[model samples]
Target: MDTSTSKVYHVDGYDSRQYLEHYFSDKPDLTFKDDTLIFPIENLTKIFKKGHIKGDLMIDLSTGSMIHYLLPSCEFFKRILVLKVKDRCILELKRWLDTRTGAFNWGHAAKLHVDIAGNSDQLQDTEEKLKSAVEHVVKCNLAKENMTDPIVLPPADCIISAWLLDNVCKNQDDYIRYLRKMSKLLKPGGHLILIGCLEISYYTVGKDKLHAFSYDEDFARKALGEVGFVIDDCKVKKRKAQSDLADYKAIIFIAAHKVK
Candidate 1:
């Protein structure tokens, strides 16, 4: 498949429920849990526990209708606002947030969160805390100067974007442009905890294949520096599960602070 011809995520849109079922369901599949979930939660726990990333507000621009990613952050941040690129994703997230019928079960993820934090008994507490912290879910357009236009959000103390750039950016320049847009959401000296795939060009969600930017660690480091973020930590984990859903060689997690 030609990278140029791959389906663009923001334009072609996504099957939010299908995506959640495939990658994040509470099935017997342990591949996604071990390979994907553990890394981000571990790093997030480490960062938040150390009191490195602080402040009252934390904005999440993560891909899909992901709630597991917010579990650990609930311990530290006062308020969490989610920004979505598509309406479908927002709806899917709201289903879970509101505890509506047919909401994707995240019990497994909540357990994993508590287990990682060394308090396996806090599963329900973690979920409740996350729900309380997440205040709003707003629609956004990265192409616009004011991504959250008309809604006007205050500059955040921290922003966590997971796997969004890999799917949204068509090239290196686009990556920088989008990163700059995300950077603007943060105040001076604020932190950005970014999670993305390295050298991955496409990922399958349901029957559709979505485009992803194939960039290495050097490119990522350079892109962060170019956007005026001082990289504080960069961790990479090689692909552990042998699956065909995505062709990513490894996952990259970076914690960086905006240059004051």
Candidate 2:
């Protein structure tokens, strides 16, 4: 076992429900109004329209507690695989996906999903599709030789990593190593869509301080290109936060394809 990846984060005990509310909850209003929502949805829309994402298999490298990231594009893929680092995150997701009673209410996110897709009537069907589309929720280690263990997976056509690496990595080298590991999950010419925070070093989980790696778009672009990815486009969305959710100047979205 690799002790390097065994940095057992107390993240399972962290307050994920509160975190989701601070960032993605639409309980306040409709319209997908937050700046956090803007860049990801808009660029994902562009990616789908440009035919950059579509195929049988989509691998989700970061399965944050919320499913908003999948709402925009999971339909494009026939099979979806989600990997998470914490049991708590997987538990939270299963509560929703399995429609259990104590599920963290994602009605607001579902409503916002319809807002992003503009399919007023597809809401119910979308939820059903999501529940069925996700093939599995497995634990993963980015530092390992095989990220997903026991179950060996075939290469994927598209990979999604949202607000992921920057939050989990402690430095630039760590970030690049994780990126290289994630890139290997894709088939040749497969697309990679990354959503990350820009210029930030830490995030809060209720009261505990969770550290992150500070970075900019140029560094991200260069890193991805050097890691066997052909750059497509990069978009940044800026917004001021009213809470201490995460300190950063902007949200960076990158679209790239595996070149090797």
Candidate 3:
């Protein structure tokens, strides 16, 4: 099956709830838990603990309505500004933030974060803290020079994009272009943390198949460098779960700072 022909993310509509249920459920595929969930939690925890990624504001340009990636960041940033490409995603996030009924539960991921901190009792508090830190969920258009047009956001101390570029980028040029836009959102010397899958080109959300741009660690490093970011840390993990939901062979997490 040629995954390159799959529907591109953001260009087409997405089912936010289904995406969460499929990849972030209580018994998610083991590899996804290890690579996507646990890996970012651990890295963010370490980065925050070291006091390098904290500030008054942090912007999140994530793929879906996902908040698990920001769970560990709530402690460091006083405000979180989330930019979503789709209205459905914004609604999905607000549903959870408002604590509405039928909202997807993220207890499993929250527990993992608390467990890593060795404070298992803070599971509920962890979610609440993230919710408090997230100050806004605004719609964004990457095609625009000011992605969040009509609202010029203050430069952030940190920016985090997870599993986002792989879905929207059709080629290397697109990756670099989109990355530059993200870089503009950060203040000089501010950090950019990226989480993405490597060397595969498809993921399933319910019955729909979505496209993913395939690239290696070196290309990623070069892309970040080209976008004026200095690499701080890069972690890659081999696929551990054998699932057809996504064909990715590995996952990557990179921490870099925008060059002044």
Q: Which numbered prediction scores highest in lDDT against the true structure?
A: 3
Model 2 CA deviation exceeding 4 Å by range:
1-13, 29-33
Better of 1 and 3 by lDDT: 3
Q: Write the per-residue lDDT of candidate 2 for residues 1-260, one digit (tens) a residue.
A: 12222222324335667666656666565222456665577677667867757999888887368677777777688889888877778888888889999877766656666776677788777777877889998888665778877668899999999877877777788778888888778899999999888898666655555666789988998899889998888888875555455577788888899998
Q: Write candidate 1's Cα lDDT for 1-260 as tens digits.
A: 33335688789887998888877777787456655677888888888888878789999997899888788897778999999999999999999899899988888888888888898877767777888899999999888899888788999999999999998988999999988988988999999999989999788886788888999999999989988999999999988788778898999999999994
lDDT per model vs. reference: 0.87, 0.75, 0.88
Q: Which parts of model 1 are misplaced by more than 4 Å? A: 1-5
Can you tell me which runs of candidate 3 are displaced by over 4 Å? 1-5, 28-31
- Which residue pairs of candidate 2 clash? none
Candidate no. 3 TM-score: 0.96
Q: Please give, for residues 1-260, the per-residue lDDT of candidate 3 as tens digits.
A: 44445787789957998888777777644436777778888888777788777899999998998888899888888999999999998899899999999998988889988988788978868999999898988999989999999999999999999999999989999999999998888999999999999998889887788988999999999999988999988888889887898999898999999995
Question: What's the lDDT of the predicted structure labeled candidate 1?
Answer: 0.87
Question: If the candidates were sorted by their lDDT against the true structure, best first, what order would they fall in?
Answer: 3, 1, 2
Clashing pairs in 3: none
